[model samples]
Target chain A: MEHKAYLDMELLRFTTAGSVDDGKSTLIGRLLFDTKSIFEDQMEAVKRSSEKKGIQHIDLSLLTDGLKDEREQGITIDVAYRYFATPKRKFIIADTPGHVQYIRNMVTGASTANLALILVDARNGLTEQTYRHSYIASLLQIKHVIVCINKMDLVDYSEERFDDIVRDYKDFAAKLDIHDIRFIPISALHGDNVVHRSEKMEWYDGPTLIYLLETIHIASDENHIDCRFAVQTVIRPHSEDYHDFRGYAGRILGGIFRKGDEVMILPSGFTSTIKAIQTFDGELEEAFAPLSVTIELNDDIDISRGDMIVRVNNKPEVTQDVDIMVCWLNNNPMQLGHKYILRHTTREVRAMVKEIVYKIDINTMQRQEGEKQFAARDIGRIRLRTTAPVFTDPYRVNKHTGSLILIDEVTNETVAAGMIV
Target chain B: MSHYYLNHLKELEAESIYVIREVFAQFQNPAILFSGGKDSIVLTHLARKAFFPAKIPFPLVHIDTGHNFPETMEYRDWLVDALGAKLIVGSVQDSIDKGRVREETGLNASRNVLQTTTLLDTIEQYKLDCCMGGARRDEEKARAKERFFSHRDEFGQWDPKNQRPELWHLFNGRKNMGEHFRVFPISNWTEMDVWQYILHDNIPLPQLYFAHERDVIERNGTLLAVSEFLNMRGDEIVHNKTVRFRTCGDLPITGAIESTASTLEEIIFEVAASRQTERGNRADDKRSETAMEDRKKQGYF
Candidate 1:
């Protein structure tokens, strides 16, 4: 066992999407195993289960198929989160099954990922799943995409095959809205180029998967250009000691917020300067995206929850109508003109779908016009008419302010995940 | 560029505090399920920070199986008073006395399974719509797929397949009458992360966590504290050993590790070197492969 000063380590969240035999689960298990994240008992349990199933070797995939049903079915049924850490960074892996409502599961995993690991079987080159996962990764605006061409052992560790696959993927990705694409060739089962560089593929001189994960610059991933704050709640100590204190509490959605910044209260159009950035550890001079803090204002504008605090000059658009790329998550098709609860950045609004512009064929990256109702696992473009104006930005700008979820009023289920166009 | 971004611990704390505040805002009656364990204690500390300069709005709910470590109860009460927060206790002994639950008999008997009925009853009777638990996903297999805002039915059952899809920072907390939610703010944290956070934040913990000489009996290679709650049989003898509990479940079935690590730093070092899962010691989990999942399906925390 090894030790390090883990207090100041950076956290990187990544998602892995692959078909059943693409070795996705093996990659995850290998990472956890090599990083010493897997405990002895867990390995023992998996080993026993694998032996019972008459497997020749320790089945790494058995470790991740968490549910009893998932194990019985020998497949991953939903997205399961796995954790591992190196000395440099702590990694959170959102492992999504590549089949069975793949779109919904991928979106759920991709929602919070800074990077996406799209696994491709070297023997199978690029399958429909590769294109689909790549497309969704692009749609979700993930900052980095690492296409791991797994099972290179089966391809005789041929550099030419890896080159062909990479070139084909590069050509296909040109059509998708993706940036910062890197390709790695390795065998997850053999522990090659996943945690350590493999000597077998000496021709491939790229950094190992672990090296890329550790060194990738993610500080610039946040939307630091525009300042946006969505108030989750208001804190009031009602005590006699701090009678007049009113602090707006929320997570910073985008950009940097500092003290003495001239800010405007959204919808209310009230202008005030930030009196202070309050936290339990004491006052901070500034806070940025993803950091939760309480902000004190110069004036009490009767602000409650769902309010936005932004710079007076740089403001998110306040709109009653939004164009969104919605992935329907419910079996019940989205009803036409039916009121659904639209929750975006802490604000809840009554919204109804007005039009389905087009539905996407994830495999071919083509859009079909004149689509009727949005059904389960359907990815498409739709227009939402909200009863109240929502302060928003494009999904590519700031994820917190850019994304929304629609809840079916009758079932009270999260029916769809939407991204602002 | 790096100065603006928070380190991982501070960021995790911030995220948890945000969730604590969200639970306060989203539910009419929310409570924290305090087990006097390190995880729950850390949760309480975060909640206090979430509403600093003001008392925690939600009452700390402890489900007592009557098989407790004396130090745990003492620490629980002391923490409640120190924070000036409300405490609500749901006792399994009371439930057993009232015939709501049957106490298991014989050597393997424990109130661990019966706590579910009392927990549900407490929730219903008190009308607690949301209960914040300090359960981390990395702790168990079934927990890895748990949602931060887990929906429970009117009958206090979880429908794993029908769980709502949680995306981004937006969580759907909508539910019908009689239904409630179990919110796990620290779902992303691992056990190592918890210890590191506790050490980094200088959070106070019960003395039982640090090594101390105590009477214990070894059963199936696990050390059990020799307390009044344990059902000792004929070949089992008690002896004093330096032991500390990694987790604070009910004292009867919760296993302890023999160690001389007396400080947080030492405990962390031991934890790093430990090969077994923390819950690997719990007799309830040792009963079957899917014991925890089965308990969870029946609304066990």
Candidate 2:
């Protein structure tokens, strides 16, 4: 394929998680190398490191060991992002550690990903770690889940073994609320069906992993049916060239937007029409999901950075009682009934945990109903009441409008990540 | 096109612009670290788009090592004039003469490391709380783990393992009075993405980026330009070659690759086919496996 073709493809961000010895890093290394994403000097450095360790072939996983301790211990200590592009798509792979203690890293990486790649060893089928990773992926509302049953070579690429693992995963996944699930048997060490067709698995007749990542329909993933825009900054040139240029600049959270569309700002509830959508150039006729543009309103209604703009009739819920799926990010336990900063879209309000309904055990997919104290790496259904009403929607509808972060007042550390539900 | 969903470049651009604005709203005093390289150039361009009509609400800070390519300096002056923004240059020569830093002596001695002392001094001298850089994660493995809002200690050190938890689009820039943050707006961009955005925006770059003839010598398999600061060995011979710089830093250490890709279009094509990483020619990064990580830890931008 032509290299320019890769430039035109849409981008996708995804995360990978598995146990320590499940060959997660090896799978990523093989995908990058087989796709020609690894450069010559990088390969040479990896080769040198491998030779120093008395290895004959290149230890592919060593390529991503970026930190000093990670290289010394041959393990990933934190979330390391790796970028690669095929002819049909651009990808941002967040390689996260799978140890139980690093569960916060997994949540952080998977927060922005549209898909999650869960690696399960073929020999082990599904273990406790597998269930933990899968549950976390589902709880994050990742639309697509691609389960790669790796190390098939060690298991002799048996069809019966693959079928049994697939059955178990199906039974487990049915209990969750994941939208799309797929199973692929792959030997990440041998580079089978990653970027190319594998003749060893003659019984398999599915697209390669790269092919699925490229062709999977993601356009329908965004919530375009609802119109939402949060004003980030107000642009006023006050110069000779563009003396009257006033634009409300922010990222499009959802829905389709265009020039001459009627819009309204929240809190003030002032209504106006979009005159011209301006970028660095001049003006654009239309804009859509994830595009940041400076919008010109017909009326110069009072608007600031932390204001919301949406369709006048189709508006989000404006209340202080916000039900959320909260994921604790810090090592400290969440302080209940304590005021913390709640940041959503462009607005910031003071909020506190009103109630902790239940905590979900990631490994068992069971809810602990009686649990009141919440700790790090724990996900629970919580009720948050903010000081000021924030305009928001359910996370299932729009990720941008439905997501928020809780900031500790004293240390200024982000303590919890929540999805409005 | 039916409702043109943003391609990769647009999405990356949108996210960067969002981060830039967040820094502006969050920090009381912020400045962009402009090295006149492609990454910084792209960043400045994005900042312009981030706050259109309203001049960028911050200044452009350049930590000069007194060993820059003549073209980069000229480009920096022109951009400052064009953007109508303030340019704050932190000079290493002044730091050396004032005994704030000492100059290294040897065949391969460089002021690259000394620039950090001057940079941290400038950050404190001006009371700039936030220093937005153009560093990218795809450039090196150490950079791959950097946060969007990277906090530095009071003494200016990077603790990769103990960074603040950055999630969603929220950036926490709050710190102690003496402490500051090094915010990378282009943390997610790759080398290819920077070039493509430059081409798409028709942003002018330094002349050294295009094919030019220059006197250089092969040092450690890298074509280092012959300069007053660069000490030539007895066996090394200087020759003029048609070359272009993939990245520009101190002239003595920054190597140029032989190429015929003069225009932006041709350069993108050449980069696409090239097997070596863009940082391969940089002598600073080649010193050790942890060269960048170590320098970053010591507050090198």
Candidate 3:
């Protein structure tokens, strides 16, 4: 493809999770290297480090292990984002560790991803880490899941081993809420089925990892059935020309909005017609999900930040009581009846934990009931009652409108990530 | 034709504009950190678009190391005048004269590290609550983990391990008094994306970004431009070479690359075909593997 066409390509943000031995970093490095994303200086530095460490082959993992302690210990401690591009799409890989202790990091990385790349070793088949990562991805409502059966070279490129792993994964994934799951056999170490079609895997007639990433159907990942627009801020130019213009600026969360469409503002229950959808360039005739534009109403209604605009027929639930599956992020344990700040969409309100319903054991897929307190990296279902009404949808329907974060009042640190149930 | 969705560049621009506008609404005092580089220039352009018909509501802060390229200074002045925006200059030389920071000595000495003290001082002096930067995550390894709304403590130290979880378009810029946030509007953009956006928007940049003939000395495999800030070695010889800078920084630390791309199209093509990262020419990042991380923890933009 030409450079101009490449510039017009779409973007796909994905997250990769695997155990330390599953060659996750090697897979990412191979993708970058084969796609010509690895620059000459970076390659040279990796080579020098490999020589200094007395390694025979260049350690591709060093490219991703960026921190000093991580490089010294040869482990990725936190989430690291890597960017690369192909002629078809631009890719952002949120590399997260697969260890159980870093579940919060995994959740943090997977929260914004459209797809999840879960790596499973061919020799080991599926381990507890695989189940944990897959469960987390499902819980995060990642629409697409690509299971890369890696280290095929270690298994002598055997078709039976590959089939067994796929079968095992399918059996385990049946318990997951994920719908779209695809399997690709790859040997990240030997550059097989990563960027290029593998000649060794004759039995596997699937697309390469790069091909799948580039051509996946992601346009429909967003919810187009419900119309939701959360007002981020009111844009009053206060200038001579646009003095009376009160534009509600925000990104469309769901469905499509056009000029002259009748919309309703949430929490206030006021109805108005969209006079215009404006941008810096000009007025847009219509806008859809993920497009940040300003909407001017025909009537001068009471609208401000933290308000939501939606279709009258398809309005989200507005209530002070919210049931959510919360992922604790900070070291401070979440106490019942503890008041915290709840930031949902563009709205901020004080919320207190009314109850801790249960905590899920990600590895075993079992719920531990009657859990009183929650610590960092713990995932549990809880009931929260906010001081004001918050409009939200279930995470299964729309990831953008369904998620919120809990911040500590004193520290102002994001303590927990919640997915509305 | 009426399109329902935005292209990649348009989407990136829209996201950046949203973030910039959010900074205006969320923080009491915010400023754009302008270094006259392409990224900052693009950021300033986005800030203009974010509030059209109305002037940019904040000032442009430039931490001058007193070793900047002359073209950068000229461009910075022109941009501030064109936008009708306020300009705040933080000088490392002044910091040195005030005994707030000491200048480095020897051959590899640079004012790059001293700019941190000056920057923090400027923030404190101006009482700027949030400083918007043009730092892209794709620039360096340490930057790859940066949050869009990065929080700094009372002393302006960054705690990478304890960063808040940034989710979707909702950014938490809430912080205590004396603590500030370093918000990166273009955190998701890469080097190629920046150049592509510049070309797409017809954004004017400093002349140093394009190919030009300059007297440079090759040291440590990088071509360092000869200037007053650089101390020449006994054996090092200056030679006129056709080179262009991939990044703009202090005159001594920022290296130039051999290139013949004179136009934006040619520059974009060259960037696409180039084998080295954009920061490969930066001497500050080459000091150690974690140089950017360490400097960033100490409040380096």
Candidate 4:
């Protein structure tokens, strides 16, 4: 096996979801602390804050609950991003508050996560909040789910209790669309089965959480068969050195784009051959998903921002009507026939909510009919008719090309996050 | 074929460049907030690559506190001239002289907090709809929750709890008139990443970052560099110490640490092995537990 250097390691972004007291923050704090990501100054500050608040033990939650109101209320109000890395891979944790009311924040956090860490208390087993979060993980098309049975010390580190909770969770998660579900029994507070193996759980045999995170096969998570490049902007350097140079600059959403490959531009339907893939360092032979590069074409096609370049044979669905699953993010309820600015990929189009199919009861995973009003944190299926054609694919196929956001024209605030169906 | 992937530093640079380009395409008027710090210098370099062959589209806005090291001012001028980019200075000294803000009178007074007023004034005066900063999430706790495209209200106040949800590569910069967005192109880069990038790209930095012999005084465990703007206190004796600044700010409050690492490689190694964060030496952030959060709420860059 070829050894990978620390700098060349791939990055893995994951989301953690747990109830208010499920030790989610503690788990993250342990990961960061054990990995030496937390510095002495930050730890000292955390200690000082703990002392000032009259807390006995250092509140690890203080490390992530950064807002003043959150620190006062002792609850996470928004999505806080935390980064730590092992030698094997770089990790980014989207720590989302696990409350039924903060579903929008969870969705926002989980939208880009490759894995979802769902914490379950050994004493309490699986609760409605767990199911809701798991359903969200499934809805957002998160491929991997790790059911961490936390606080095993409270249950005396019994293997039988771990088995029971795993069984219960498995039965409930059978309804979810998630694959690659793994179970681990450990105590986040005591640092068991996290970065290091716990001697107490002798009967339990599995890789540690950090080990699993570092070794997960995420290279295939992206869709490499479909080539999608949404032009974000045009790089036109009319300088004397490189005058008349026009390059399309954007990040490759999926698949591989190589020089000399024939591609077609969307909406305009103009075809051209890729002349070169350029970067600041130099030109490349090919580029793949998630890489931001500039491409020069042989033909001077009248292409601009919001246009997509793809293979001629493979194409995304371009239509005016789009079916979507929306999670409302604003205080105002989503009204039918209300116009909004829909931002998909790099294109923006005016869209109207034509109909609300049904609202899903997140706790029970049942569709609730006769609900016309969609309030904040409401997840439902809706039909939208756009003023112009938007190129898209199914959310399950390509996350980058399938997702969008709705902006209220009056306030220009993003009101809803949508996944195309 | 061998599997190909970008190293961490290259990936961060690409992401930042992409963001800088997006700002150019999305906003009507955008400017780079250059602070003469390493992070801002890296941001300026990324902007240069983001629009290579063409001069940087946006002007560089410097919020001058008038208490900077001479080395920093000289480096800033040289960089702006070399890049051939427009420079706009927002002077805190001018603000104080015009009675726009009051200067601090205490022994430990700093123009750090006062820079916010000059920054807001400059933005309003220039009608800058978008201002790009070099803030990283790893620097402070409150910054961890900041979005790539941070929105500011008409009054330029940041509501940390009510930030817009940023997903994937989709960033929403649309806003009503009189409101602007503060875009951070390198929010994910860490101190190590910054040093590694500087080393890899051979990016030029101010001389203060490298270790050198300088007159300093120990106060509250922080080494205060001897400068004209820094007021000497009684019972404090000046001593020549080989030290280097972890961060650049107003010379009065910005602290330096004793280090022998002079070269970029040695600095990188030292930073990698250091126990405390880079911002630990900044006296401005030590004011309170939630000092950065409070400053961010009031539109402090």
Candidate 5:
């Protein structure tokens, strides 16, 4: 048996964005293939596809195209996820399309990503599509950004061209709300500076893309100050062996959970003590953020689905009226004063849009007021009135418990993504 | 004896539990699709942990093809009695007897494709709004792009390309009167993670997973167990070999592999070092390149 070493770290998700023919697929393909994370059958499928296309060479870009129609059209039209792992960390790649008309697809992909991989062609410099992708990535609160200057092979791997493009990108990215920005020169077609160092660029001095992905410090990405746990289901064996096990099953939204702690259940206002935390293997003394475990309480209360369990001292905002920034996702336009289903955490209630305060322009970042009508893929601010009081945190406070979705009652489709402001 | 963190495995389990709860909160009538396989068994156990002190909210629905292994039937019955949940069995034999479906007769005859007809009929009769499945994305190419709450049309058909956009933790489970959702809680788990979690969790499985002496014959580099449903060819010779199943299915199609691993720990180690996939031995999948995709399009869970 081989000895496996464990590296403790947090999880980081990122999405790749660019225009058509900007080599976004090739760049991602190089990262997965170079890491030796591509499965055998996946590789075989790519090989057979490339052969059918009669390219006479293995096209690495075929790896991310999961659908048959996408392969036949030679483009990525939807958001697909690809997973890989190194000895240091695990990676989840949100491979999104790079077309202008599919801006909604980019938003859906970058919604949960911690970083963004913005590809740039060295010869073409920066296009309007590049700016749009970067702008949306910034709007989604992605803190880390990597601007990969690709196609250095066509320019004879010139250092001057690489520096020229990096300067142009910096000037545009400075206007956005971006903090951490890095540049790397690479030829994704030739596999340079992606996983291995390229000798052609003698003046380039930096770690390869694979090295950065494996060594980037992302341990403190989660908010651990506030404690929140939404009750999913109440566990009860009701058998002879174990009868008095009243456990609250849910994922810890934030903070830490330890034995002998005081807790409160929402809507019911019942308090109890945390007796033990149990997994499948055994009981643990403590559990933390993002880990799901069954929590046994000292006292059994009237807690069910759509109820929240939190620390007594720390509580979320409980209100029926909320101001939210919503992005419309359906083709039909938004109808004012219309009621729909608003699902937050584990609770669902009927909600109506009271007023549309304003809509944000994606190109200029300006607010359009008094324009209440919104089409598909529209981002705007609105006030919502629900039937019942819901507990929620700000979007910045916690991503899991703060966000929600709006569904059309008639069409039964997810009409929008809403974030509590 | 020591401090350890199964980071990936724990994350997968947490994600699955979250999805299970989402189904319970969103849908009105829900049930689990249990086949007595490893994945379904793991799902049943997770449902048990999801609601402690209270019973599992939903029942277990099995679309039996009437060609299952004996061990699987015994395990399924025992689990149902222990959990005290209702078990609904939709038989392919019943469907065939009533002219709901026809049994194919040829060299490559199989009941795998016919299971879809029985499954859809069962869903329509029960009026189940959501059916939780144990399908994993890592097992097949068609399943790789599936969402947590997969939507089915009025005819119980799955459209692979035009799926609804699923983002963040918000799952949309709204549908019309006839449509339903097929939710997969463990869509992100792989074969290796499933094995490790089973070992760590101490989940009981069928005896066919372990090594035993069985009369089998070699066909297309795979060992097929000799049973009543399977007809032996002239050139094929039967012999006794120590074999175990990678995936549990019907008696005629699912093939077993030669192995010496008899314990859970040994099976985990053997799975970790193997290069071939776990579904490589499925004779049903070897029928055509798009066999699974076609079956899925016709509403096979």
Candidate 6:
């Protein structure tokens, strides 16, 4: 490929959640190996380790399980990110363990993923692991999901078996709040249909796994309908050239922002027209989600960090009490009535736990009501009272403005992640 | 059909800028850990773009090992002056002089490990709550698992086993009084992406990154620049070879690679065709399987 092609290539960030039994590591290994991403030295190191351990075949997990203990135990304990590229796109894999206890790790990996990859053993179709992974993907509002029926060689590469699993998965996923679900049958260990089209499964007509990864429609993954720009900081260049330049610098979280568009400043409720969208490259006609730019307003307004710039007609709710689906991320249980530091959009406020509505059985999707205690990795619905009114949209409407993380006041650890309901 | 979607480079640039802005808003005191390397140069450039029309809001902190190449020092000084930013140098030699850290003794001994002490001391002295670094996740295995906002204890130690979970763009920068964060704005960037961006933007880099004739010695199949900091063995031989450094660090431990490529374009070509990682030449990471993990646990950058 030409060097210029690298510039045009799209970047796809995806997360994979599955147990070692599901051949998850092998699938990842296949992706890297087929793409020739694993360098000779890295492969050599893995070979040496496998030889030292007297393994029959090279263990692909060693490439990803970077930590010493994780390699020694032959299992993944935390989230590990792996990178690879094809001619079409650059990929970042947020690989997480699928153990029931490591739900926190899986959630961390899922938070920023544009797509989720859930592996299933072909022999066992649509198990609890599949449901858990699918549910988390939906809860995190991941738009796309790819379910790979791995270890097809063990099931004799039977088209009937693959179709049956796909049918079962579709039936279960119909209840999920996700779209763009796809399925592919492959043997990760045998290198069938992962990067290469499986000749054995010629009965299947879908694209290969790598093809889907490269061509999937992710241009619309971010929220482009709600105009939300969280002002991170105000840039006042007290320099000779930019003496009069006072620009609000931030990353646009939602819809497109055009020059001369009427926008409102939150908390202050002041209105201003965008004078110019400034960047290091110069002025832009418009700005959209994920671009960090500076905005010069036609009128002066009281704006600072934690303040937001949104389209006047399309505004997020400004309120103090919030109902949320809380994921317990810390080792200690959630403390009721204790003040926690709530970090939203660009604002940080003190939060008091109001009440626990119900606990979610992640695997079964059952709601256990009136449960107040939440241990590590527990997901539940809760109400919180922020010391100050927070500007937020429901997570279903906009992931950027709705998501929050709670930090323990004393220990200073990020204890919980809350999705505004 | 333009979809308002950024390409890979623009996306990466936006991500880095977002992270930089977060550090500024979240922390009272933050600084960029500068090593005068190309990565740090890219970082400094990104900081400029991040706060554009204005100067960088944070100081550029350099843990000077006193073993830097002359070209790197010149570049460092010139860049600092150009940016009009504060440059704070924490000297490893000073730490050695003050007995805060002891120097090692051997033919392969380097001040690479000693610089960690000076770095932590600098953070403590400056009361820096956050130290933005240019370290990429693709550089090393230990770093591959590192969070964008990596948490360090009051002792300046990193616990690989237990770390805060970073989700979405919502980075938890909360920490206790003495604790600080090491933020990597370019954590997702690869070596190829860095070189490609430099080429596309015509960014200036040190001549060291390009091919040049330098005095070097071969040891264990890698070339080490001949400098006073290198503890030469009795039987060692020095030769003039055309080489360039893939990574710049303490002149003693950072190995130079034999290359005919001189310009940014040529370097990118070499990088795309090269098989080894960027750190394959660094002797520090080759020490053990988990050498980086061990160093990171003890607060090494």
Instruction: Residues B1-301, candidate 3: write the lDDT tens digits.
Output: 2245566787788789889978987899999999989989999998888776467888999999999899999999999999889999999999999999998999999999999999999999999999999999899988988988999999999988778888767789999999999999998899999999898878999999999999999999999999988998999999999999999998999999999999989998999988899999899999987899999999999
**CA RMSD of all predictions:** 1.1, 1.5, 1.6, 1.8, 3.3, 1.3
Which lDDT value does model 2 have at B130? Answer: 92
**First chain of candidate 2, TM-score:** 0.97
Model 1 clashing residue pairs (backbone): none
Ten residues in a row with the worst lDDT in model 6 chain A?
Answer: A1-10
Residue-level lDDT tens digits of model 1 in A88-190: 8888899997874767888999999999999999998998888889988999999899999999999999999999999999999999888899999999999
* TM-score, candidate 1, chain B alone: 0.98
Clashing pairs in 4: none
Model 1 lDDT, residue A313, Cα: 96
TM-score of 1: 0.99
| lDDT (Cα, tens digit) per residue for candidate 3, span A1-421 | 3678977888898998765588998999999999989999999999999899899999988888777777888888788889999888999899988888888789989998989999988988899989998998998999899999999999899999988998999999999999999999999988999999999989888899999999888878778778999887787878788879888888788989989999999888999999999877889888888887889999999898899999988999998999999999889999889999999988899999999999998779899998889998888899999999999999889887899999999989888999999
Q: Which whole-number lDDT from 0 to 100 does residue A226 have in model 2? A: 80
Q: Pick by lDDT: which candidate is best?
A: 6
TM-score (0 to 1) of chain B for each candidate: 0.98, 0.98, 0.99, 0.98, 0.96, 0.98
Per residue, candidate 4 scores C-alpha lDDT tens digits across B1-301 of 2364556676687788879988998999999999999999999999988776567899999999999899999999999999999999999999999999999987888899999999999999999999999999888889999999999999899999889888777889999899999999999888877887888788999999999999999987899998888877788899999999999988988899999999988887788678899989889998888899999999999
Better TM-score candidate (1, 3): 1
**Model 1 per-residue lDDT tens digits across residues B204-250:** 99999999999999999899988788889889988899999999898
Write candidate 4's Cα lDDT for A39-108 as tens digits: 8988998999899899999999999988889899898988888887777787888898888888888998
Q: Give interface RMSD, per candidate.
A: 1.3, 1.6, 1.9, 2.8, 3.8, 1.0
Model 5, docking class:
acceptable
Model 6 alpha-carbon drift over 4 Å, by segment: none
Best by TM-score: 1
- Report the CA-based lDDT of candidate 3 relative to the real structure: 0.90
